[model samples]
Target: MDFTRLSSVLTVVGALMLPFAPASAATLTFEDLNSGQASYDVVPSPYKGFAFSGWFYGPDTVYAPASGSIDLFTDYADPTDPGAYVITSNNAITSAVEFVFDGAAFSGYSGVTFELWDAGNLVATSDSLPDSQGAAPYGPTFLASGYSGLVDKVVVSGVQGYFSMDDFTYHAPASNNVPEPGSLALVLFGLGIGGLSARRRR
Candidate 1:
């Protein structure tokens, strides 16, 4: 075949492969934790496979010993006044609860999108937590992708002073394309022609 014809065929082949290359599918879900401090647990109902867990702390307070129960002192009290209601701990106070999941085991997803609702202001470890803090909720939302293997943990701190977490969730990509034998046969046929054309051009 002439070089011009060969180039035209190669361009067509490249166009065909474009759709199958890396594509981003962003999705999210939310699981509510009704007024409680608990370790991670699987989300119920529509989102059963995903799991989430976290704890709350007051200013200058240590986490409670119990796993799935809320501690009013550490979980509800205000970090500034101690006598008042503080959702997240003071910045000076470091320890906070962590929530994590095995992305591969649970949903076969590579990453997650996290959203937090704190009645008070929150200081996220990963991103700069939004500064505006009040009874009205405010937090950051972003994509987490590119995983070598299963994702073990995702930590969100500052549950004490003005920070609180209402809902945590995980999302899976929609398409799981595993080609059937017939589809593979078609691809192989195209590849064979492509190989012969490549050899002739050489």
Candidate 2:
């Protein structure tokens, strides 16, 4: 093959291999509990190629004397089971929750999984299995597609008394399948080729 043709083939092959490169793994942990200012933020667009999204809950504040606890549930509508799992004011909530990927960045994750620790015990878990209350009704819902840029805020509602948010976290996919560089690199390389061809013709 001529130098020009060989160069073209190598460039194409390199472009294709770029997409299969390993992805970076990023984890965001929410461990600060500030009164009225309790939240976690994650920019999945940066590392949208993650393979897993997880959240963990630890013990509660022993000093803060509160009446009610926080319940961990997905963003869904189900008046019947308002508080899925109760995290009392005295104990810790620890659980490895998993989420589903929809093919997009973090925007694709629409489910929330975690254990609700009530009074220091694993009271309930949010998963695909059926709950004692019967079939699982509402699931962890994400904001509308248009609102993907905004961080999806989840708050524990319907508390009998008062409580505080200690920690939260979110994980993202880290694989070549999610954000493949093949498409992006190919486009850029194609643009380069187009420009070169145009200049040669001129």
* TM-score against truth, every candidate: 0.32, 0.23
* Number of the predicted model whose lDDT against the real structure is largest: 1
| 1-202: candidate 2 lDDT, tens digit per residue | 2467557767876785675564442323222221333432222221223211222222222112121222222122223444633322222222233222111111111222333333344444333222224343222232211211112222222221122222133433334264446776776687678756766776
lDDT string for model 1 (43-81, tens) is 332223422343332221232212222221213333356
Clashes of each: 12, 8
For model 2, how many clashes?
A: 8
Candidate 1 residue 134 Cα shift, in angstroms, is 9.2
Runs with alpha carbons beyond 4 Å of true place in candidate 2: 1-147, 158-167, 170-192, 195-202
Q: For model 1, how big is the CA root-mean-square deviation?
A: 13.8
The local lDDT score (0 to 100) that residue 14 gets in candidate 2 is 76
Which numbered prediction scores highest in TM-score against the true structure? 1
Query: Scored by CA lDDT, what does every candidate get?
Result: 0.35, 0.31
